[model samples]
Target: MEGGRWDMLEWLGPDASISVFNYLDNPADLARVGAVSKSWRKFVISNQFGKRLCMTLCPEISNFTHIQLWKRYSHQNASPSTSMDWQILERAHIAYTYFAHCFLSCDSDKDCIMTCIGASSTDRFPVESIHNTLVPTDMDHMVYWRSSYWSSAGQADPNVQESLIYHLKRGLYLVNEIRIRPFKAFFQVGDPIYSAKHVRFRMGHSKF
Candidate 1:
């Protein structure tokens, strides 16, 4: 049985030991290697093997565990360049924002809500007229809103009034609510009529 195990391990290829050690050095590699085979996937996730895999593949993983993995790697490896670090941080921010948006927009959840509005104006009267015509006559602006399950369940407070005020001050028309979720809602705001198209509104996000 030991000889059989040895032969099987041998059959895993000449680089099998290196591959295993690589995973031990940086477990993040499992993200890619996991797709290779069911046996490999099992090996990657197995507690006895997983720690080594993480150590082996830690250099490459970029999902939610990126920061922690990078921090550990940095202790043993040269610190990454500032530009690379910034890029990673930016990507993490985007991921967080995306997750937040998804959470707040998921259906049947009402814990948070968001609203937005946008508008534009042109110098040429004729061009402005044409643009207005393309938009709904009744809607010189657009608005979107979403409510999360938690908010609806009374577990959290709503900020509909503050959101409305913010948009109105910027001369944006509130079109409608786009989505609602447990964490957020999105709304659309339009620019004020006769405002120059070049005069972009200073848009921002605020928790209400």
Candidate 2:
């Protein structure tokens, strides 16, 4: 070894060592490699080995997933230090990749890839069932999304506009499209999803 230190991996050169690390599938192992030595850390981050492994693990994440969402959040939270840390950046990248996979990969046609985990609304079916089942999940009843749901109250006198604010528990999502399904009356002979004659939609990124 160069500085009288017994570098166990001294036999393998930088390029070769990276090749070996590239084979690591476990994200924890990659993170631990950084703590092993500064050289190993640099090697792992320089090639973004973690991000590569994440891509292999989640094939559904396309290049159009808008990586800028992650970058924007990362930069907002980043320290003022001059040198950028690719290792940290790669970790965030991998996290967002997995999060995107959770929402984008669907088995059924009605399964919306919307990452909306929770919702708040000006009106709901019943005041008690607000947060229970506003969005579709795999566990929803076979045909119907769920018996539990939300809906706007009376829209008469003033004809107020109804609004439902969906939330993402993970982080800022790079959403291209959002699917909305009107509720169905299960007791009816042919249970059908009722549609609103006209609907309005809006998207935004909020700091609060």
Candidate 2's error at 20, in angstroms? 0.9
Local lDDT at 97 for model 2: 40
TM values, all candidates:
0.19, 0.55
Every model: Cα RMSD to truth? 16.9, 7.4
Off by over 4 Å in 1: 1-19, 22-24, 53-208
Candidate 2 lDDT over 1-208, as tens digits, reads 7777766557787777777887776666776887788676666666767567756766554473434444545545445763555535555555644453544455323333344333344354443243434434333322243445554554564445545555544454444465555666454778766556678776565433
Q: Count the clashes in each prediction.
A: 65, 0
> Compared to the true structure, candidate 2 yields what TM-score?
0.55
- Colliding residue pairs in candidate 2: none
Top candidate, metric lDDT: 2
Error of 2 at 73 (Å): 9.6
lDDT of 1 at 15: 63
lDDT of 1 at 149: 14
